[model samples]
Target: MLPKSILEHTLVLDIETVSAAASYAELSPTMQKLWALKAEALQRRLAEEEKMTAADYYPEKAGIYAEFGKIVCITVGVFTKNEEGQYKLRLKSFYGDDEKVLLQDFSAMLSKYFQRRGQQYVCGHNIKEFDMPYICRRMIVQGLPLPAPLQIYGKKPWELHHFLDSMTLWKFGDYKAYTSLKLLCGLFGIPTPKDDIDGSQVGRSYWEDGDLDRIEVYCKKDVFATAQVLLRFMLEDPLALIFESADG
Candidate 1:
């Protein structure tokens, strides 16, 4: 089992996103033109799929870009002491159609919690490259003030002790290896977050099925799995059930 110390006050986060519009046809004429150019620039990565066109790429790849996508859910988990003085995780999700409202609420919670607890760790799987930067970009797009922990502009590398990435930690300085959260969970024997749906299905769920609730649940599961993966990194039992207590 994991030591209580490692989990305490550490934040785990995950986000679910979808294209800002339901379909390529729904995008503004200007945005469609922009995406066409962007797709052409990225076409080299699809060397084996030369048949795929820009319209074909939008549904699959656009959500990974904050400029083209919208975050439908952002789930954050933290270990807190229960009434019995035992450490257990608590998960909260901010989600809705109005991205600005959810972002504001999430930042407010971050500010209030960190103000009370002092500076601390903010962690997730592949968080350094994807989650944090995407959030910052979206916040700027919305003209929202960044939370203190996210004001990373021009800070020295060592100054970001509060930031952590489970994937980066596992790489052991192997910069080329890109490990997915699901792969780490399986390697560590933690429950898979893909039981319900995968990231590829998230956009379809939101735009076609209108299943935001399912997306929120999937996001929480990933956050929980991330915590489990981190515990394994601390040389603890990856199956630790402490996170089972996390209330969403």
Candidate 2:
């Protein structure tokens, strides 16, 4: 049982990722030849050098691994209350395969949804910082045109007329410099899903197992969490949602 304002719009979001690519050395032909000639020498030198730390290990030709560059999976989930006044989960769209097709489909789907529901809002957890920026970069890379509705770079931080960040709302006032969706879900007594997959396993899943479905499910769970946060923010939270008293 929520007011109309809270159930007025839907939230759409997605994520992209790339798996372990060649290390910096493997990319350079000169370094490749060096490795070929002096494997032991290089290993010993690397072992001694601070740069050779375990953190520097990179999978060999892992496959187009880019930091905040390519998108691996795009999961879009929508939240709306049906006639019965019960919140429902609608996976509006889930696209993950070729990066180009995914982005195009994502943009098209968003455009269509916005066109039909002109005034609805779109939201996600940390979308402003990660998902949106990553998607934009991929679009630019593929030279695919971004639909008018998906053009979000021009909007101001607090002036997201059509987009909202669930994380932002949850971390009001003393908003921490870091807040993971999982962490916030825990604080709010929401059950965060536990799966064997994470961003780190994405590349392996994509290449070895070709299990985009798992990734899609993972992304959907995130969207569900985001929707839950929005629900709590706009209705369940007494501090945020002001309800009329029975006496009134």
Candidate 3:
């Protein structure tokens, strides 16, 4: 595997999201409308799931998967080598309150990082198909500008000068089936996060109690897991893409 020094320019990111919802029956007309739309989307998604599990591919269903919900928050944790050869992660979170402002802040941070280092990459679990696109879409939704590095699509996956998705790397060959972050963590023997809270529960926590701290903690744990998986890739030398390759 490549030495840790070679990966000094990589950043690990993870995010949390919550959709618009109302807890009690009495709600404003605007919220009622948003809730209705979200509910309809959820029902269609459930139907699609049943059909998809039966070997049916539905384009509309895939679209639902893509556009079901909007991002509520994004937490990015950047890891790099210190002078002492130890990895340190610095973290920041963008709460989706005033999404435009948050996205602008995020873009500014990316710009600052790139200018400071000249080159850096994003490394995350399932980032290519999910997290990266979600961030881009959220930015677009807010009508905020995106930095050039964030627009890394349409290039050869291996030719990407920056950005690496751990799930993509793990799927170096076989990618026919879905593999989750939790599953890969188990394979690498990385301790998974405590299950007291999960992605599904975050939305409830956010809408019901306005719990940003819990969501931040959950996001950090995901970032930590993502970092651990990347460490295993760079240091453990267990996977074929690493141990068996000349690059190692």
Best by lDDT: 1
List residue ranges in candidate 2 displaced over 4 A: 1-6, 20-68, 115-118, 237-248
Q: What's the CA RMSD for each of the models? A: 2.5, 8.8, 8.1
Ranking by lDDT: 1, 3, 2
Q: Better model by TM-score, 2 or 3? A: 3
Which lDDT value does model 3 have at 160? 62
* Off by more than 4 A, model 3: 21-68, 82-84, 115-118, 153-161, 236-248
Summarize candidate 2's per-residue lDDT along 35-121 as a digit string, tens digits: 344334335655455334222433322222233235767776665556666666566444556678878877887777665324677
Q: On residues 8-120, what C-alpha lDDT tens digit does candidate 3 reach at each position?
A: 57777787765433332344566445545655554565655453321112112222232434555667766654666566666667765455676787788788775432267
TM-score of model 3 relative to the true fold? Answer: 0.73
| TM-score of each model, paired residue for residue | 0.91, 0.72, 0.73
Local accuracy by lDDT, each model: 0.83, 0.59, 0.63
Q: Show pairs that collide, candidate 3.
A: none
Per-residue CA lDDT of model 1 for 132-187, tens digit only, reads 88999999999999998889899776777677788888888798979998899888
RMSD of 3: 8.1
